[model samples]
Target: MPKLTIDGIEIEVEAGTSVLQACEALGIEVPRFCYHERLSVAGNCRMCLVDMERAPKPVASCCMPVGEGMVIRTDTERVRKARNGVMEFLLINHPLDCPICDQGGECDLQDQAVAYGKNTSRYDENKRAVKNKEFGPLIKTVMTRCIHCTRCIRFAEEIAGVPVLGATYRGENMEVGTYVEKTLDSELSGNLVDICPVGALTSKPYAFHARPWELRKFESIDAMDAVGSNIRVDVRGGQVMRVLPRLNEAVNEEWISDKTRHAVDGLMKRRLDKPYVRGADGKLKAASWDEAFAAIAKRVAGLDGSKIGAIAGNQADAESMLLLKELMQSLGVASIDCRQDGAKLDATTRAGYLFNTTIAGIEQADAVLLIGTNPRKEAAIINARLRKRWTMGGFPVGVIGPQIDLTYDHSYLGAGPQSLEALLKGEGEFAAKLKAAQRPMIIVGMGALTRADGAQVLAAARQLAEQVGAVAEGWNGFNVLHTAAARVGGLDLGLVPAAGGRDVAGILDGADKGEVEVVYLLGADEIDASRLGKAFVIYQGHHGDVGAHHADVILPGAAYTEKEGTYVNTEGRVQRGRKAAFAPGDAREDWAILRALSAHLAKTLPYDDLASVRRRLVEVNPAFAHVDDVAPSAWGAFGAAGAMDAAPFVTAIDNFYQTCAISRASATMAECTEAFVKGRQEEGKTGTHG
Candidate 1:
């Protein structure tokens, strides 16, 4: 440890600790623009200049290492004058548009200027003006407002692993943008706006919408993907203004995917605000809640339990899924499933369906094997983590799926079950690497488990995990990467079919053959609704997407942002999202809707309130007893024995932005799809960019 004195206070810090960090440890604030804790230290912005004993001049505290007996004076006259000079130079070209700038309130540059800058500037020369550059639909760029902090550049290169952004010129003529005119193709591009210290990079969708102080912020969890990223929802009046990532090191770590941040626009569009019922003409007409419930009761009055089925969606919360399961069980409806993607998941054991190693554990892993999964598209944050681990060196990743750029160096093992079989037989170099690794991980994706031989593939993957010692004591690296937020929670609540019941495919087959009479969809739009031939479909969701479009009775339910609901991430971490704004118009909470409909069916559930429903949840699965905590599932026998097929494994998410009902309805997401996904295809620029 190196002992150092800052502002007359003595403290000891780590050898490599910078003076800025040491000052911060002693409750002193040292301002800097180009300095970010997560990024590499760049001491170009001399705002954190500090006077030091026995030094020729003030030092840049951000880059200066702490030394033994070093006295750092941060509150001295020289420090203040240096900071003022830096601020003046920064403002020389900075436009006086703070009142109109979207980053006025929350900008670090604005805040630091008020505290450290002088009232008047000595130089009155012509301010440099730089033209704005395009950075796709999600980000609005104002090059003139840029402070050349290089945060965005570093974030693009290091975090996102897409080095599309960089400094193009030298000194005062410098500019940060793509070398060629192109849209940022990274899924984690929204984070650039969050890391920008000035008004240079801002959200295009959220531009000029609402100020930070004008909106009410609520801490919540994102259900956009299975990462369950902690988020802060900002609302103005009865509308959600925007969603920003919250700091959760165990999960998202201060960053969210573009969909999680920009999908708030979809909440206000294509909403199922009021209940609807198909009339005699077979067209959906707005109906009262009582009428909608009556129609459901009339259709399901004498239907046999075996003829009734329920399918839950990707974004369906735990509380709603639990209530729906209980309601179906009470009515003797055994044909229920949460795997709308028709994945052959073995819910018999918790470990089989969970990311047993946890998201944070990815950093500790020395070697990884991906089975029919693309973490880059399915879960961008996890890919970022993988890249982070890869940047530290000594971590090797092997992929057995589509040849996609995972933003890191990975060994592309063949593309089918045969490749996995080859590895299991110890016939490959990567296989040997995994066996030699201290902590090896194998991630099985939905792509591997949605086929006819999915169970067999899963079993083979488990056997490989065992062979490679991935499931050792205190470190189980066998993980299942789920793209759906509700999959784990639904599995935890036993939402799968009961004894002698059918899975999602069987339920749909029965419905198509007219063997199933009533099919209930709880926010389930991912399934093929056309297979529901002659089946009286009752859709309970907040979007008028595929499910609602083909529904016989549509019961408007709350979206994730409109209700207090529980969700389990892929890591089996239980997290809750609070209501930021009420559901549009007459849409009610999903659990409440199910609770009220139970009365219509004369099979009323026991729970009257959310608390009671949660109590029932704990009774169903004791894991629900701990909120925001992950109780690692005991390693045991999992997966079913079967024959392996020779077919190539396909990835589940072909389109990242338009995956779910909410995202499908989002104009911003559509813009992203057009600009990034489809536009890239049209432009014939599918290769990597610098």
Candidate 2:
């Protein structure tokens, strides 16, 4: 440990701690730019200059390491003069468009300028001007206002694992932009806008939308992916203006993917504001809630329990799924499934289907094997963690699936179950490495588990883990990387089919053969509508997507951002999201809609409000009551659970950007998807020609 004194206050810190961090620990404020806690120290922005007793001049506190018996002064005249000079130079070329800048109220440079900058500039020459370049549909640029902080550049290279962004030219002519006119193709590229100290980089979708001071912010959790990244929803007059990442060290680590950032636009498009019922003319006509509920009840009045089925979508919350399950049980409907992809997941134990080692455990892992999944597309933040671990060295990664560019070097074994079988048979090259690793991880994607022989693939993977000693004392790295945000929550609640109940595939087959009388879809849109046959479908969701198109009756429900609901991430960590905005006209919260429908059927649910519904959820699953907790459970064996079948593994997610109905309706997401596809095609061409 090193002892240091800041403004006459003495403190002792760890050996590698920076002077700025030491000052921060002592309740002393040290202003800085380009000094992100997660990124490498650049020491270019001289705003955090502090005077040291032994040093001849002021030093950049951000890069200066604390030494034993070192005395630093942050409120001295020399430090003040150095900070003022740095601020003046930074503002020499900055544009004076505070009133029009989107970051006017919350810019770090603006606050520092008011605190340390001189009243007027001393330069009489013309200020430098640089033309802004179009980065993409999500980010807007104003090159003239840049302060050369390089935070965006470091974030791109270090955090995002992409080196497209860099500085061009020398000295004052240097500007931050891509080497060519290319889009930032990283899934985590939206973080650059949040890291920029000035208005040079702002949200293109949120330009001139509203000031930060005028928006009402609410803490929430992201539903775009199964990682369940925490976020802050900013709303203006009942309309969501933007979405920003929240700091959760265990989950997102203060960073969110672009889909989670820009998917708010979908909330305003193709929304289901009122209920509708299909008429004899084969057209959905507007109807009151009473009429829609009556129509649904009439069709499902005398249906047998085995003939009725319900499916929950990927974006649904735990409360809504629980309420829907209760309603179905009350009406004697046992054919229910939340896994629309027909995944053969073993939900008897939490360790069987969860990311048992947790998200942060990736750093402690020395060896990793990805089976039939792309973390880069399915879970972007988790990919970042893998990249971080790989960057630190001694971390070997192997993949046994479609050979996609994971932004990291890994051994590409053959795809499908054969490769996994070879590893389990101790015939592969990486098998020895895994057996010798201290902590190894096996991440199974849903793609491998949704196929006909998914159970076999899962068993082989689990067997490989046990043989390699992956799960032992203090280390359990058997992970399931899910794509849907609601999959873990549904599985945690044991929302699978009961005995004699039909799964998703069986229900769809029954409906196609007219064996099923009625089908209820709770926001499910990924299934094929052509196989629904003549079954009377009742869609309850917030979007007018595929599920609504195939339904005979439509019930409008609130989105995740418009209702208070609980969601469990892939790690089995339960977290609740707060309501940030109201639902559209005639739309009610998802749980409320289910409760009302139950009443119309003369089977009034026990819960009346969100609290009671949550209570019921806790009663069914004790983990629901303890928010942000993963209850202890041991891993289960899957070898004798099923027989091996000869089938190749297949991924459920084809497009990363537009998976759910909400993201499908987002124009921003569509643009990103197009650009991403184009980039991938170009890369393919380059690979072939090379």
Candidate 3:
């Protein structure tokens, strides 16, 4: 421990603790621009200069290490003059555009300048102007206001692992951008806007929108992916202006994907604002709630319970899924499934389908083996964590799927089930590495569990995990990376078929063969609607997507942002998302819709409100009783056995931007697909960077 005195206050800190950190511990403030707690220390700003006893003059506190009996004075005259000089130099090149700047209310530079900078400038020389650069459709750049903090550069190299951004020139001629003109290819590019200290980089979709003060903020959970990232929704007049990342170390640590941040536009577009029913003309027409309910009742009236089926979508919350399950059970309907991707998941045990080694636990892993999963697209934040782990050294990763850049160094094991079988037999060098590691991880994905031989693949993965001690007494590292935000929650609620019921494939097959009569889609849009044949489809969702397109009745329901609901992440952690904005006109909450329809069907559910519905959820599964807590599932046998096939494994997510109904309806997401997905494909064809 090193003892230090700052402003006549004495304190002891860790050996490697910096003076700036020591000052902050004693309730003293240090102004900094290029310093972020999560990022590496870069003392380039010189804004945190502090006077030291028995020293030459002032030193950068952010990089200055504390010593035994070191005296630091942060409120002295020399420190004040040094900070003022640094602030003046920063303001000299900074453009006077805060009035129209998007970062006006919440900018770090704006606040620090007012407190530390002089009242007026002394020089009258013409201000330097730099040309703005493009960083794709998601980020709007104004390089003229840049302070050269290099936060974005470090974030690209360390966090995103893209290394596409860098300083091009030296000194006064320096500019931060790609060496060649191109949009940032990282899925985490939107974080640059959040890390920048000034208005140099702002959200392109959110440009010229409402300021921070004008928007009403609501803390919520993001439903874009299975990470269940903590987020804050900014609403202006009942409209979602933007979504920003909230700090939660157990989950997403102050960062969100571009889709999570920019997909608010989809909430206002292509919304199912009113109930609709297919008339005698075979066209959907606006109808009252009673009429829509009647339409569903008319089709399901004398139909056999075995002929009725329900499918939950990716964004379906726990409350609605529970009510839907109860309603179906009461109606004697056994055909139901939440695995719209037709994944062969064994919901019998919670550990079989959860990320057993929680997101934070990735840092503790020594070896990792990815089986038919692309964490970069499926869960960008998880990939960032894996990169962070890899950067610490002594961590080795092996991939057993399609070769893609995971933003880290990983060995490419063979492509399919044969490679997995080989590892089980201890026939590879990577398998030897897995056996030698203390805490090894094996992550299974949809690509391995959505095929004809999915059960066999799952059994093999479990056997490999058991053989390599991945699932042991103290630590269980066998994980399943899910792409849907609702999959874990739906499974936790036992939304699978009853003992005599069929899975998703069997339900769809029965529908095509005239064995199934009524199909209820609870926001399920990813399934093949064409295969429903003559089945009367009833779609209850917030978007007019594919499921609604083929529906016989559309009962408009609330989106994630329009309702208070619970969602479980891939780690089986229960999280609750609050209602940020109201659903469009005539649309109601999902659980309320199901509760109302239950009465029409003569099978009224007991729960009347959200609280009652959540209580019922806890009864269905005790895991729902603890919100924001991860109750580790007891590790046991996966109980799956079959023969392995030689087919090559494919990547689960084809397009990262347009995965679900909301993102498919987003114009901003569409633009990203054009500039990133399609543009990259075009670039690949020409062998040139765009």
Candidate 4:
């Protein structure tokens, strides 16, 4: 460690810690356009220049490592002059269109200019201009506003690992643009807009929206946090202003998907504002909450708890999850499940109490075997890590998935029941390599397995480990990708009713067979209603979707934004999710509804708040014993659980904008979908199925 003084404050930091970091540690603010916490230090902008006691000239602080007894002055006259000169140079070509610019109120350049720049420049020369190039739908660019800090370029080259963006000219003539105006094809392309230091790059949709001061920030989770993530939402006038990563280090870290950032608009879209019921006329009709609940109670009263089933979607909050389980148990239904039938099964004992093996721990594994899932399309961040593991030698990545997912970057494809045998038997060169490697990992998620037959895959994965001697004793080797923010936690709570049906499909089939008198849709969907018969359906969710369309009764529910709950991550870490806003309209938390309905029937479930439910979670599932103790906002480094870390790198995730409901509704993603369809037609494989 080295001791350094920055802005008259002294602090000790690791020998390798940059002076800028030391300054940050000592609570000294240094303004710079190019420097980011994650990216490599360039020191190109010169805005971080500081006057050091020994150095004759000011030095850029971002690239300078801390040294013993180094004294630095960031606001001295000499340092101020240097920074002001640099700022003057930066403003020469800048458009200075702060009023109409999307990044106006929040632009780092504007702030720095006000703080470090002189009132005017000495040069009377013409400002250089560069041609604007079309990047893609999500981001807009005005090349004249670029400061050449290369934050966006570095983010593209290093973080995202896509060469779509780069500086195209010499020195002052340099411009940030794509090669030949080709579409910015990277899945994580939208992030460039967030990182650009000036008004050069902006979010196309957010342009001309309310200024930054007009928006309010809210801390919330995403639809995926059912998988355990904490995120922040910037809202203005009851609508989402933007989405940014909240530092939790455990789940999402200081990173999030375009989906999590943009999907917030779903709260205002096609919402179920009022209660509804299906009529004899075969259409859903608006009804009072009392009328709907009464009908549900009457129908539920006729059923045996053993014949009932409930399924919860991964997007619902933990409160909603607990409520649904209570309702089912009261109705004597134990066949509750969220597993997608017929894909894969996770019989690894504590199936739902799973998290990402600590967010980037997969990067450290000497070997990775992906069984039946596409990280790129579904779990983008994980896929990005796996890609780095594969491409940059972070590790040798192996795939046993149903498809040749591009995220594997260098994958050996295997599928069916035989997929596991290949790794066990070392049938191919890829499998042989994976078998011979140490620190091997098997990640199982959506595609290879669902709630249906995912157990078979898990069995095969375990068998492969046993046969190949790949798994280390007492360590997590087989990882199942969980779906919700608190899916792991909810499952840990043993919220699955004792008498519910086997799965949703089983209940639907029972409904088809007239065995179930009334079907309760508990925060669940993803079924094609066209396959089921005329059984009474009850839908409970924030969104009005196909399930609500077929419902005999409907109940509006609170989204993750309006609920307080605790989630157990797949890594078995407990996280608290607090409410950041109110329910939209006539909407109740899932647990509230279950509590009301349970009280109505004169029964009580043994828990009160999110904390109490978590206690029951630990009681029912001993696998989650540590969950009650982990703090909600706590996060650990990747591979901190005796695991290796990924490279000093970040992988751009899948098309986040395309995955979320709001972005899906955006014309941008729709255009991409159409283009994809066209490409499929061009490939002459329009109807191919995997």
TM-score of each: 0.99, 0.98, 0.99, 0.86
Which residues of candidate 1, in runs, are more than 4 Å off? Answer: 683-690
In candidate 3, residue 28 scores what lDDT?
96
TM-score of 1: 0.99
lDDT of candidate model 1 versus the reference: 0.92
Order of candidate numbers by TM-score, starting with the best: 3, 1, 2, 4
Kindly list the per-residue Cα lDDT of model 4 for residues 372-442, writing each as its tens digit: 65566555555555655566675766666444435345565545546565566677777776667666677
How do the residues 308-412 of candidate 1 rate in per-residue lDDT, one tens digit apiece? 999999999999999899889988888999998888886789999999989999999999999999999899999999999999999999999888989999999
What Cα-based lDDT does every candidate model obtain? Answer: 0.92, 0.89, 0.92, 0.64
Q: Which ten residues in a row have the lowest lDDT in candidate 2?
A: 638-647
Q: Tens-digit lDDT track for model 2 on 1-690?
A: 988788888899999999999999988899999799999999999899999898899999999999999999998988899999999888888878999999899999989888988899998778999999878788899999999999999999999988888999999899889888777788888898999999999999899888998999999999989999999999999899999999988888999999999989999999999999999999999999999999998988887888899999998999899988988898788889999888888568778888987898899999999998989999999999999999999888999888788888899887777788789888877988898899999999987888877777788888888999999999998999998899999988778898888889988999999988799999999898788999999999999999999999999999999999899999988999999999999999998899889999998988878888888888888888779776666877752346555455555676788999999999999998777866677778888421
Q: Which residue pairs of candidate 2 clash?
A: none
Q: Candidate 2, which segments miss by more than 4 Å at Cα?
A: 639-648, 682-690
**Clash numbers, per candidate:** 1, 0, 0, 36
- lDDT tens readout by residue for model 3, 1-690: 989889999999999999999989999999999988888998999999999998898999999999999999998888899999999999887888899999999999999999999999987888888899988899999998998999999999999999999999899899999988888999999999999999999999999988898999999999999999999999999899999999999899999999999887999889999999999999999999999998888888888899999999999999999999999999899999999998988678899999999999999999999999999999999999999999999999999989999999999997999899899999989999999999999999999888888878888999999999998888999999999999999999888999889888888999999998889999999999999998999999999999999999999999899899899999999999999899989999999999999999999899867888888888889999889999969877673687877889999898999998889889999999999999988988999864
Measured over all alpha carbons after superposition, the RMSD of each candidate to the real structure, in angstroms, is: 1.3, 1.5, 1.0, 6.1
Q: How accurate is candidate 3 locally (lDDT)?
A: 0.92
Candidate 4 regions exceeding 4 Å error are 1-12, 52-56, 66-71, 225-227, 341-348, 351-356, 387-394, 402-408, 413-416, 431-438, 451-453, 466-470, 495-500, 601-672, 675-690
